[model samples]
Target: MLVLTRRRGQAICIGDNIRIVVTRIEDGQVRLGIESSDNVTILREELLETVKQANQSALSSAPEAFNHWLNQQPKAVDDAGNTKDKA
Candidate 1:
């Protein structure tokens, strides 16, 4: 990690399009302002981790839930292999 001391209004540039600026400092808390393109996604670390965990949980449960749903559907064939279509 690159660490630098920046006072209020100081700015740092990343690549060609992204910029991070120190906006305010008060009571040992620092506020930052970021500038980037419209396509860029900016997320807090804790919020990003929460989203990752939620995605993992959803993926883990998906197969079992899908199988259960499939089992509940009406069968398209009979035990003798004949098509069971309602006329």
Candidate 2:
């Protein structure tokens, strides 16, 4: 990774479409303001992980496969003559 120092209101450029600006520095935390094109996506770690997991799951399985897996699970019965899963 490239390392550089930027004070408040200063910015670092990444090519022509992206920029990172130093917005705040306090409590040992450095805040950055990102400037990017509309097509670019920037997300927090957990959000990124969710997106990746969703994409991977979609790619690795089909609707039919999921339905088959669901069918294999044990069914439930209730005293009211309804499936236990039914409300």
Candidate 3:
């Protein structure tokens, strides 16, 4: 981890398009402003970890759920070569 000290209004640049600016410092809290392209995704570390765990849990259950859905789908082939439900 690269750590640096910056006073208010000081900024750091990452790569060619991202910038992290120190906006304010208060009692034990530091506020930062981030500027980047719209394609960039910025997330807090804890929030990112939570999202990763949720994705893993969903993926683990997906196979069983998909198989159950496939079993319930009708095995009829339509003229367009697509699976269709029997009426």
Candidate 4:
């Protein structure tokens, strides 16, 4: 991983479009403001892991049965750019 030091209001770029700016530092928590495309999605690590577990549970509940049920539902995009069924 690339490591760099940045203060509040300082920013970093990812690829061509995404920009992450350090907005504030308080109690060791850093607040960030993201300037990027609307299509871009981001999620915290723990939340991402939770979503993965949920998806695995959903998929494992049943194989053919779950697949059939999932196929019938409309897909929704989650905060992490993942598609999830509303069911």
Best by TM-score: 3
RMSD of each: 4.3, 8.3, 4.5, 13.9
- TM-score per candidate, in order? 0.73, 0.63, 0.79, 0.67
lDDT of 3 by residue, 17-50 (tens): 9999999999999999999999999999999999
Q: What is the lDDT of residue 70 in candidate 3?
A: 78
| Cα distance off (Å), candidate 4, residue 20 | 0.4
What's each prediction's clash count? Answer: 0, 0, 0, 0
Can you write out model 2's per-residue Cα lDDT over 35-85, one digit (the tens) per residue?
A: 999999989899999999999898788887978888777768877866754
Q: All models: lDDT?
A: 0.92, 0.87, 0.94, 0.90
Residues 1-87, candidate 1, lDDT per residue (tens digit)?
999999999999999999999999999899999999999999999999999999999999999998888777776787889866432
What lDDT is obtained when candidate 1 is compared to the true structure? 0.92
Better-scoring candidate (TM-score), 3 or 4: 3
